[model samples]
Structures are given as structure tokens and as C-alpha cells.
Target: MAIVALRAPLKDLAGGRSEVKVDGASVIDVLRALEAEHPRIVGWILDEQGRIRRHVNVFVNGELTREDAPLSADDRVQVLHSITGGTA
Candidate 1:
């Protein structure tokens, strides 16, 4: 199983938590499983098209991962904000 750590800002929407783990053969596979667990976090990390949103950054083992990035059971996934600021 790989671990998916959700940042604090996003965690607020996930019942105020820090991290979560999911089982998968790839990042996308684990993300799908995570969505099943934290359904609310679905839109937060993924777009309506079921793809990772641009604003939300996903990193594997501290390195940003692209759609084609390969994921293994030993990898770790983290979801965070890459945005700077919004309306004040």
C-alpha cells in the first residue's frame, strides 16, 4: 500500500486530517481507491474529467508526478496546493 498525504488546507475538506493510505499498482489506481474512501476529496484532487487538476499538485516520493508517471506499491503520493493566492 502507498500513502497519500493530503496537505492541511485540503485536509480541512477531508474532515480535518493529515494523511491517508490506499492500495494500488499505480498512482492513478491508488487515487481511485482513495476517492472511494474520501469521496469528498475527489473534486479537490481530481477534475470532473477524472484527471488530476492543474491547481492541485501531486507528488510521488517528493517529486511531482505527471499523468504518465509510474507508481509502485512502495511509492508515496501527496496532494497539495500549487496556487499562490486567491480573491481577498
Candidate 2:
């Protein structure tokens, strides 16, 4: 199982949990497991095409990674909401 840390609204959506334990072989799998537990988190992290949203960033062991990235029992995954701003 991997330790998934949810940030901001993601955590808010996940019943105010900061971290969750999920079993999966890859990032997507972990996400799926998480979604299974928290249905409201469905479209917040993944899109209709089952892809990570552009506004959402995922990191594995402190490094940015793709959805297909491999995972291990001891791995730590962080899901963050990207902040975007435009000059007035």
C-alpha cells in the first residue's frame, strides 16, 4: 500500500483526511482505490478520460510523476492543486 497525501480541497473532499492508505501498483491504481473509498473525489483528480487533470499535480517521493508511474508499499504520493494566476 502507498501513502497518499491529499492537499487543500482534495483533502476536504476526502472527509477531511490528510492522508490515506491505498493499495495499487501504479499511480492510477492508487487513485482508483482512493476513488473507491471517496466517490466525491472522482473528477477532482482524474478527468473523464481517466487522465490526471492539468490543474492537479501529483508527486511520488517528492518528485513529479505521471499517472503510469510505478509504486511500492513504502512509496509516498502527494496530490496537490496547482495555483494559477494572471496579471491584471
Candidate 3:
């Protein structure tokens, strides 16, 4: 199983759990596992077409990953929400 580390808002949605274990082979599978636990998370991480939202980033073992990125049993995944700001 891969350990998925959740960002603030995602963690909050997962009942304060910062990490979750997912037995999956790819990023999509991992996200599906997370969604299985916290149903509302799907909308937050994926778009209507089931693609990862542009505002969200996924990292596998400290490297950025795409939806098709493969996972290992000992791999660690981090799901983050992008924060953007501009000078006024």
C-alpha cells in the first residue's frame, strides 16, 4: 500500500487524518481509494472529466506525478492544493 499524505483542507475533509493508505498501482487508483474513504474529496481533487484539477498537485515519493504515475507498496504520495496570489 502507498501512503498518501493529505494537505490541510483535504486532511480536514478526511476527518483530520493527514495520511491514508491506498493499495493502488497509479495516481488515479490512489485518488479513487481516497475518494472511497472521503466521498467529497473527488470533486476537490478531480475535474468533471475525471482529470486531476489544475489547482491540485500530486507528488509520488517527493517527485511530481501525473494521473498515470505508477505506485509501489512503499511509495509515499502527497496531494496538495495550489496556492496563488498576486500583488495589488
Best by TM-score: 2
Residues 1-88 of candidate 2 have per-residue lDDT tens digits of 8999997788988999999999999999999999999999999899989999987889999999989999999799999876753235
lDDT minimum window of 10 residues, candidate 3: 79-88
Each candidate's clash count: 0, 0, 0
Which residue pairs show collisions in model 2? none
**Can you tell me which runs of candidate 2 are displaced by over 4 Å?**
85-88
Q: Output the TM-score of candidate 3.
A: 0.90
Rank the models by TM-score, top first: 2, 3, 1
- How well is each residue in 41-83 modelled by candidate 3, as lDDT tens digits? 8788888787988878899999998999988898999988766
Per-residue error (Å), model 2, residue 33: 0.7
Can you write out model 1's per-residue Cα lDDT over 1-88, one digit (the tens) per residue? 8888887766776677777777887777787788788778777677778788877788999998865577877687888777753555
In angstroms, give how far residue 61 of model 3 lies from its true place: 0.5
RMSD of each: 1.9, 1.8, 2.0
> What lDDT does the true structure give each of the candidates?
0.77, 0.92, 0.87
